[model samples]
Target: MSGVQDQLEIKFRLTDGSDIGPKSFPAATSVATLKESILAQWPKEKVSGPMTVKDVKLISAGKILENNRTVGECRSPLCDIPGGVTTMHVVVQPPALEKGIGIVQDIAQTI
Candidate 1:
């Protein structure tokens, strides 16, 4: 069988606190690519650039989320407990929305 056929299925959560269904991807998928996929799912919501993944935390089953570490960097000892490789939790911080110039002008006029 091909490597892709043996790839594992995992679930990822969006920054908006939404649960994304399990997806099949190669084990070699980078944390950065995962972040991009999450953002793409929610096009309407504002999301920070690549750097935002630095703040994401991957939570495994039973294990609590403590420090901020990307899945790629998280390994044994830190989160290598048994039965911890299947499920993962990612914390994504949505991008901030700025008021339009016209809106600001209108508010200023009202003041």
Candidate 2:
């Protein structure tokens, strides 16, 4: 016999100042799973290492997102879009650029 399934709606904020919202999926999903789904939508962004839904902030009605809580760790599966949801927030931190005197010297020689 088939049983009713619980669904959840997730929203993401991109660094580009855009917002993705109203993404619905099955409940009881893990943070890793949700990250995968988000990546599918935004292939340009890479999410690795310590970055995760924990960095995502929920700005909507019926719920309040806490600084300590992450989307992956939240008990509420359903996310509502009340307002002020900016897709501009980045889920992953960008990699740092390498620094060295050799690189600058090479550029100077080329000039």
Candidate 3:
């Protein structure tokens, strides 16, 4: 007899200290899908500038996660120890230098 693997309810803790969600998905869900969800739920008010997928990264248990991997594939030690639910970390990278650092220039003008 075969039984289904349980879906995971994953919450995200942002590097900016914002909490995103406890979104649920199947264990086989792709990392690309997860990132899309995060991008959707990200707080627009919290943004200092424009955001992009390339600026977002997900980490678990101190390890950077790859977009092609599944959540289950990247499950961290914390996920197993925390009574079953998984919490991932989100890091927002600085936008590419091509973006011109307009926010920084604006801040300098204010100072």
Candidate 3's residue-wise lDDT over 1-111, tens digit each? 112344777888987676877776777788778878888887878855326667777788878888888877877654564335577888777766646788779889999
Stretches > 4 Å off in candidate 3? 1-4, 81-83, 97-111
Candidate closer to the true structure by TM-score (higher is better), 2 or 3:
3
* Candidate achieving higher TM-score, 1 or 2: 1
lDDT-sorted candidate list, best first? 3, 1, 2
Q: Cα deviation of 55 in candidate 3 (Å)?
A: 1.3
TM-score of 1: 0.44
Return model 3's CA RMSD, one decimal. 6.0
TM agreement with the true structure for every prediction: 0.44, 0.42, 0.72
Question: Arrange candidates by TM-score, highest first: which order?
Answer: 3, 1, 2
Backbone clashes in model 1? 1
lDDT of 3: 0.73
Put down candidate 1 lDDT per residue, 1-111, tens digits, no spaces.
Answer: 666433555676554566665676564566566656654554454445334554454565545444433443433355443333355666543333224666888899999
RMSD after CA superposition, every candidate = 8.3, 9.5, 6.0
Candidate 2 root-mean-square deviation in Å: 9.5
